[model samples]
Target: MALGTNTGGGGVGAGTEVPALSGAPLLGSLHDLKSDSLGTYLRAQQRHGDVVRVSAGPPGMRADLYCVFSPEGVQQVLASEAANFRKDNAFYQEVRESFGNGLLTSQDEDYLRQRRLVQPLFTRRRVDGYAGAVAAETASVVTAWEEALDGVVDVSDEMTHLALRAVARILFGTDVEATAEVVARCFPVITEYVLRRGYSPANIPRSWPTPGNRRAAAAMDELYGVCDRIIGQRRRAGADASGEDLLTLLAAARSPDDGGFDAAELRDQVLIFLLAGHETTATSLCFALHLLARHPEQQDRAREEITRVLGGRPAQARDLERLPYLSQVVKEAMRLYPAAPVIGRKAVAATRIGGHAVPAGADVILAPWVTHRRPEHWPDPDRFDPERFTPEAEAGRPRYAWFPFGGGPRACIGQHFSMLESVVALAMILRAYSFEAVDTEIPVGAGITLRTEGPARCRIRRLDGPVGPR
Candidate 1:
């Protein structure tokens, strides 16, 4: 896919482009780095400082993309002057078609109203209430792993299944195994379409009836059908009288004007929650596990902490507070491999970002991939060091320098839930097994989220008894 276009403007500054290194283009090939979007952005930054314009779309039909990597620029895009940006674009339109107008893609009054309705479900207190469910679902998955013995397993698939199950149960109060099958059938279509749209604008036409497009359309239909059935069942049974799960809360939610989501709106919200809530968290855990396998010392330290806290038993939400180091590991893993590595917005009006005159309609890409790896913001940014997130160390940096879950009003609503889920799952898995990465190059894959290209193959050894020292 062509990277993005460079609309009607001469390059901003002749001096801004980094000198060619080893004859490589200052801006790398988007297709060559298709599997690793973050790596492409990082390479661009290495060659072209904080801002680089890249070509997107087919030759002669591309748009100009302005990538902002500086900390000040990232902050401006995410928080300051956020109102000057909107999510209505080719990229988000694909998302809307797949997930409907849910929290992830809905804009304007619709977005605001839906956000208000769904906000309460993710409030700190309410999320805390779902901790038991998270632990239960994670333990259930781990129990199944135990049955497999200490053999090699695809940790990536396992984590994806585990996260999808947890989200399904908590959001819809549904069976994990059944919902997982549905998600499995649905996710590939969602991801494939997301990638196709990102790579080529022409691939987005709903009227196109190509094989890939047909499969994607079918997958979306299946997903929505499942969601519709679940909603109908809940409504008929009146299962959410108290509004515990997110679906229940959304069902009972009322807008500021006393208007509530209709059946279709509720379905959209549920679909977004089911897909976004689980997929991104699953990606993070898979990467975290891989990182842990690579860093035995850190993994051992985290294991020791987990064992000390839970005594080789299941973890609880309360245990999260005491597992600070484990949290650091997760934070560090996300820093290196953020699931949503790049976030984009279009300038609705003329604006100044990091002192650069951003013309109206210009595409502004805020790459967490580049920002997180910045040498000035992170000491030895490439190394896998969780200490960078310790309260003391983190206090010294800019707040926007490390937004794994993004920032501002549009930030992920399930941030706390995802963090708690990762910490618990990491603690549990570490306590049960010591893992090592199989000696092989694990290629990176990028779609709407980042993932391993092949199996995240790893060898696992059972820890010394359940109650032994971690």
Candidate 2:
């Protein structure tokens, strides 16, 4: 409990010791840290040893915080002893209010059943089916950019638009133009309320008449109305067997034991897809573009690889295997600026992590933001270095050293789809334009997904001539 005193190392063997911090602060001061939450945690790790404790919020509602810096400690939390943790109750409690029993927020049997039904839809073969749609969408977006008048463009906003459109097409077979508009209008409300709930837990009572809460309620209603209409039309048209779009797949997905998703469950799942399918990918795409703009050498290298693979044509799924460097760029970007920086869990039972005893009901926080950039695992962790992810380099590191999508059975189910979309989109954008960041510092804001605090202003002009191949 003393600040700066080393807590005895938690693990059994030598070097596995959790270094104690003497008189280390229990929680970090939000004001002094970088706006980026992950950066803040990483800074905390520097001052407090790897397994520092944190005071949650106000007294009486306080929760225990555990920051896992070592790969072994992270693997133990995420993989080896996964069941000891559940999605942080406070976080999921808010998600349940909006998403119901959707896979992202659900736990235990409900989570397992939903995951099983949805897993097949993301298989290599199934996700590969989305290649054409992904490429076409990327092409369409790039074409628009190519035609734009010369000026500064907010690539973050643009990528958000593109990602939502792409996910919409993959999920419901709707065109980007239509779904993007709907998502744009509804997203702010969802984001605002979720953040408010996260920060001020006591203000989330159902009976609260706050304007933000009311707006959130209204947005949910509008979203549900849209989803219901979509579902109704699909059912009435007897389109259940027509295609493998997520809607059709979910409409037909049955729990082998129990029938299929009930009316409410189906609605929740669709909402989850609409939100998770788009938001996280959009954040990642924005950050990737932001990184690319700042690191022109890395950007040019990725573009070179893309051109070598596909010439001047659009990239396809088949090309992903050949575009290892481009994939590594995306992976590195996610490592530095993961869409979801912090993943939390609540102990369902008493557990020991990093050799420290965690009592039942204790809140456990695992931040990829802190772990991914730890200097111990990554050299010059802040630098934009894609080489670290190359096959040889990756093989040398522990599995949990760079978990942006998360790890274990509860990892992001749409990870494969997201990766494919990012690679193709990166290829399209690089082929069309050369982008540069307007400033050295790109501000990040964290909501349901991590995003730029303001527009990621960049100068995007059509490339004057063909760049050489990879």
Candidate 3:
């Protein structure tokens, strides 16, 4: 399989099609893709090699997909020659129904403009400042857990709440406990509807009065209504509004080309930030804690590092560098279960990948969940080992091999923020509590992000002092 150079942004029909992974007649692989997306991708890659054409969607009429699982293929689709690939695919088009033209769903010029506008919000200094908020939120959750010591807790749910609160504090500059509660209730509805549309080959239009669509519409209304209330209240407060939050910044920012983000655009970006921001980070943290619980030795190693570094003090932004093992644990957990498991892009121009012809309008899937676990890139791919992410070990691997936050120019803008938040949260939690895995079998599911099928249950024990020995 030879790599193809980008041949300008021009559309061309697929020259030589790759072999197809056989699935049910007419349905093709849609059911498999929707049912067990992770298993389907891994199985396809194992059977058909790295790049296989997936015959999904309607019987014909250009519903073919090229699933790319190799690191080289991932780099091509996500980074190099990314301009030829667009987010204007079926999945993203449906996502835009709820997300609007936010960074997650927007493409091309609009995407570039949005990226430029929002990038500054996540600069190193800005993300560094968020560490304090992340630590504080984690500490708050820890305090709550202290009351419930010896009780079983849903780690996933708690992480979700913690993430929402942290993002609320960082992005809104005020506590949105009430708003977060509303989102926590309604966002799942939006996720359920959007996930169905994203994975299903034949999706009912949102305009149709289907029961699912009706529920989705109501959920969007409620979710957006919450945003409206927050923004509305801020507007009413005017000068009293916190001048440093992302919402305030967006309200003030104006673009010469598009005249800046209007009310609708503001709502879209804020909703995306609130929804995407909390969920992915929460998912990653949940998996990290679950992994640590499963491996007590590794957990002890991390806790020991945190105890020695802080010497009984809570984790803060300045203490990150001193906590290398904790960082490795976070990276390894993300490798096993990347938050954004699959990245989808549609080809706007004709291209060749792995010596096979890829035509315009083909949906390209770059799945880290599959690629990260590839034996070539990772040894004992299923094992939970943080040593793989050590500085010495990471230098030998490809940049895209373990991208939990993604890669390339269009990689997650909140990558730094997520990492800082996760590490700080993990360190703080380890300082106060040690989790024991209550459910040995944790089921994986696919939604907006890779998610747990049910609440990841863990037994919590509050630590009296240092995690090591006494």
Candidate 1's C-alpha lDDT?
0.76
| Model 3, C-alpha of 418: deviation from truth (Å) | 0.3
Better of 1 and 2 by lDDT: 1
Model 1 lDDT-worst window of ten: 14-23
Mind giving the per-residue lDDT tens digits that candidate 3 earns over 1-470?
Answer: 00112222345555566778898876777677767878888888989887887765554432567888888888888889888887767677767887677988887788888887777777888778878777777777877876674578889989999999889887677646767777888888887777777665456568999899899898888888878877776666666665677788777666676567767888989988987899999988999999998889999999899888988666777777889999999889899988888888878777888777777766777888899999998988999999998899999998878777777878889887888888889988887788889987788876778888876889988888633212
Segments of candidate 2 deviating more than 4 angstroms = 1-36, 147-149, 175-178, 239-241, 464-470
lDDT of 2: 0.72
Task: Report, for every candidate in turn, its global Cα lDDT versus the true structure.
Answer: 0.76, 0.72, 0.80
Query: In candidate 2, how many Å is residue 324 off?
Result: 0.7
In order of TM-score, best first, we have: 3, 1, 2
Task: For residues 371-462, write the lDDT of model 2, one tens digit per residue.
Answer: 88878778988898989888999999889888887888888898888899888888878877888898557777666777677778788878
Question: Model 1 over residues 138-221: C-alpha lDDT tens digits?
Answer: 776666776664578788888988888888888877545566688888888787877677666355467689888788888888
Candidate 1: the clashing residue pairs are 3-55, 3-56, 4-55, 4-56, 5-56, 5-63, 5-64, 6-63, 6-64, 7-64
Query: Model 2 Cα displacement at 43 (Å)?
Result: 2.6
Per-candidate RMSD vs. true structure?
3.6, 4.8, 4.2
True lDDT of residue 436, candidate 3: 89
Pairs that clash in candidate 3: none
TM-score, candidate number 2: 0.89
Worst 10 residues of 2 by lDDT: 1-10
Model 3 lowest lDDT segment of ten: 1-10
